[model samples]
Target: MTQLETAMAILMKVFDTYAAGEGKPDTLTKGEAKTLLEKELPGLLKAAKNQEEVDKMLKGLDFNGDSEVDFSEFVVLVAALTCACHNRCVKK
Candidate 1:
């Protein structure tokens, strides 16, 4: 599959696991992002080594500086990560 398609699939999988049977779309709430940083990305997201660190990181990615992160921003963030991990992955 293409990188864009692969990234979307990975992101959807991540969101599904986070939603935990909620059937919710792939949107990232503040809490969900924090959990992802602290738990799922332990080594990758070790800014301050805690939830507060994750919150700070979230602020930077929120773009509009809004308290919550919508799917658009979340997708961008996930795409960036995918690209970082797999150099040629995800076309943005």
Candidate 2:
């Protein structure tokens, strides 16, 4: 597969793995989401100045106000982070 295709697959797989942890298999409960954050995106949590900031990040992910993160919400987080990193690197 192409690089983009591989990335897409990985994203779906990561979301699926975490979402299956609790509650519905198609969406992530807050606890499951937190676990995914801590494990899959440890650097992001480390970069956060404190737990408040991390909480805010997680809150921001639930765009639909449904108290859970679906695949689209997860993808938005990934895309936003990708853009932020790319912009920072390009500015260097």
Candidate 3:
């Protein structure tokens, strides 16, 4: 599978862990995913004060400008956030 697909799989795993079996994986609606990102991923998306901003932030990361950021975009942004966090830790 492609890198984006891999990232989507990983994202699914993350969500599954968060939801704690309260919901089905296939039935994970966009709002639920958005909620996860907005509430849980504050470090990765600092300016995401709300779900719409979170959605726009994700959209902005779409390098191909296809109006859809798949797993690749998601993973790359997460990786960048991870690196940034690590660097900050080192600096401190």
lDDT of 3: 0.61
Q: Can you write out model 2's per-residue Cα lDDT over 1-92, one digit (the tens) per residue? A: 99999999999999999999889999998889899999988998998999989888888899999999999999999999999989989953
Q: Write the per-residue lDDT of candidate 1 for residues 1-92, one digit (tens) a residue.
A: 99979967887787666645333345556677767666677777754677666667788777887666666776788778777889766467
Report the Cα lDDT for residue 24, model 2.
96
Q: Residue 48 in model 1: shift from native, Å?
A: 4.0
Error of 1 at 73 (Å): 1.0
lDDT for 50 in candidate 3 is: 70
**In each prediction, how many residue pairs overlap at the backbone (N, C-alpha, C within less than 3 A)?**
0, 0, 1
Error of 3 at 63 (Å): 1.1
| Stretches of candidate 2 exceeding 4 Å from the true structure | none
lDDT of model 3 at residue 78? Answer: 72
Model 1 gets an lDDT of 0.69
Where in model 1 is the C-alpha error above 4 Å?
A: 1-7, 19-26, 47-52, 85-92
- Candidate order by TM-score, highest to lowest? 2, 1, 3
Report the error of model 2 at residue 37, Å. 1.1
> Each candidate's lDDT (Cα)?
0.69, 0.93, 0.61
TM-score of each: 0.58, 0.94, 0.51
Structure candidate 1, residue pairs in collision: none
Model 3: per-residue Cα lDDT over 1-92, one tens digit each: 89989977877677565444335443323454455566678565576577677677655666777554444555676788789879989954
